[model samples]
Structure formats: C-alpha cells, structure tokens
Target: MSTKYKKLILSLILDAIGLIPIPFFDVVWAPASAYIMTKMYKSKEGKIAGILSFVEEIIPFSDIVPTFTIMWVYSYIINKEKVDTIVEA
Candidate 1:
C-alpha cells in the first residue's frame, strides 16, 4: 500500500489503542497523536489537528471520535482543497 495509507492505518490503530481503559494510556496517546499528525502533514491543518487530537484524548469521554484518523482523511482526501485554502491564508 501507499505511504499515506500506511500512515492512516497507523493513526487509526494508535487511536484505538488510546481508547484502552488503562491508566496514562491517554496521556501517552494524546501527545503521540499530536506528534504523528504534525509529522503526517506539515501545514496549518496538521497543527490544528495535532492540538485537536491531543485535546480529544485528554478530555474524558471525548475520545469517542478518532480525531487523528478523521483529520488525516480530511486533510488528505475528503477536503484537500479546503486545507490548501487555509494554508494560503
């Protein structure tokens, strides 16, 4: 598969692992997701996604959404043009 798909799958797995009900898992995951998101996309959207993913994991009950994977899809696929517009601003 392509590198992008690999990164997406990795982010999804990390997000799922972040959901485990173990102590400090979210703590580790939140920052990790942030870093991964930043690495995957070097743009404003990536920065926002990193922060958003971190927040989503840090807040209890907010982890229901896989922010990292969702952001990946949004930035790279679903709304690629939108991110470019934001970056140009």
Candidate 2:
C-alpha cells in the first residue's frame, strides 16, 4: 500500500486503540480519532473514521468493541483493501 494509505490505516488503528475502554474514559480518544479520520477523509475516501470513534466515546466503555466492529466494516467499505493486520502500538 502507498505510504499515505498506510498512514491512514495506522491512524485508524490508533483511534481504535484509543476507543478501547478503561476505568476512566480516554478523553483524548475521540478527538484524536476524529482528527486522523478527518484527515483520511480529506485525503482519499470520503467516509469519516473519526465519527465512529466519536460514537465509541458517546457510548459506555462496554460498548467499544461493538463500535470498533462497526468502524472496521466502514473501513472495509471505504478502503476496499483486505488489510489482514491490525496495529497494537
């Protein structure tokens, strides 16, 4: 994949990681996710990844997994690339 798309994917993964629940809400999660996804939207696909990250923030901690799943689907639809890997860092 091109470096830009790689970066976008990396950013999306970062958003996903941030969305993962903890004892306290990660306040930085949604905004960071939104910023990266907005950048991706502006760069390539028109769909917004940040919005899904926002949804995770709006919901309770337990709901993050479901939100992540939805976002993954959205990513697939928009990117059309079967990237088997997901980032941990």
Candidate 3:
C-alpha cells in the first residue's frame, strides 16, 4: 500500500484502539492523530486537521466520529484537489 493508505489505516486503527474503555486514551490518540494528519497531507488543511483531531479526540465521547479517517477520506478520496486549491488560495 501507498504511504497515504498506510497512514489512513494506522490512524483508523489507533482510533479504534482508543475506543477501549480506559481513561486518557484520548490523550494518547490525540497527538498520534495529529501527527498522522500532519504527515499525510502537509498543507494548511492538514495542519488544521491535526489540531482538530487532537481536540476532537481529547473531548469526552468525541472519538466516535473518527475524525482522522473522515479527514483522510475527504482529502484523498472525496475531494483531493479541493484541499490543495483551497490551501494555495
């Protein structure tokens, strides 16, 4: 698999693992998600995603949405060029 797919899968897996019913799993997930998000796209959107991923995972009960995966899909699948164009604008 490409590096991008690998990152997406890893982030999703981490998000899944963060679902374990334990305290402070979000703390671990947040930074990891942020790193993955920043690495994947390396644009303004990616930086924002990194911050949002951290925030989303840190909030209680917010991990249910899989922000990293959603961002990945949106950036790479749903509207890849849009992110670049918007970032460059």
Instruction: Please list the C-alpha lDDT of all candidates, in the order they appear.
Output: 0.76, 0.52, 0.74
Per-residue C-alpha lDDT of model 2 across residues 33-61, encoded as one tens digit per residue: 56655554443232344576566565565
What's every prediction's RMSD, in angstroms?
Answer: 4.1, 6.8, 4.1
Give candidate 3's error at residue 19 in angstroms.
Answer: 1.4
By TM-score: ranked, best first: 1, 3, 2
Against the true structure, whose TM-score is highest? Answer: 1
Model 1, residue 86: C-alpha shift (Å) = 13
| lDDT measured at residue 9 in model 2 versus the true structure, 0 to 100 | 64
List TM-scores for all candidates, in order: 0.78, 0.47, 0.72
Question: Candidate 2's C-alpha lDDT?
Answer: 0.52
lDDT of 3 by residue, 7-85 (tens): 6787688668657768877788778878866876577877898898888888898778777678778877898667555
Q: Which stretches of candidate 1 lie over 4 Å from their true place?
A: 81-89
In lDDT terms, how accurate is model 3?
0.74
Model 2, runs deviating above 4 Å: 8-12, 19-21, 43-48, 62-89
Query: Which scores better on TM-score, 1 or 3?
Result: 1
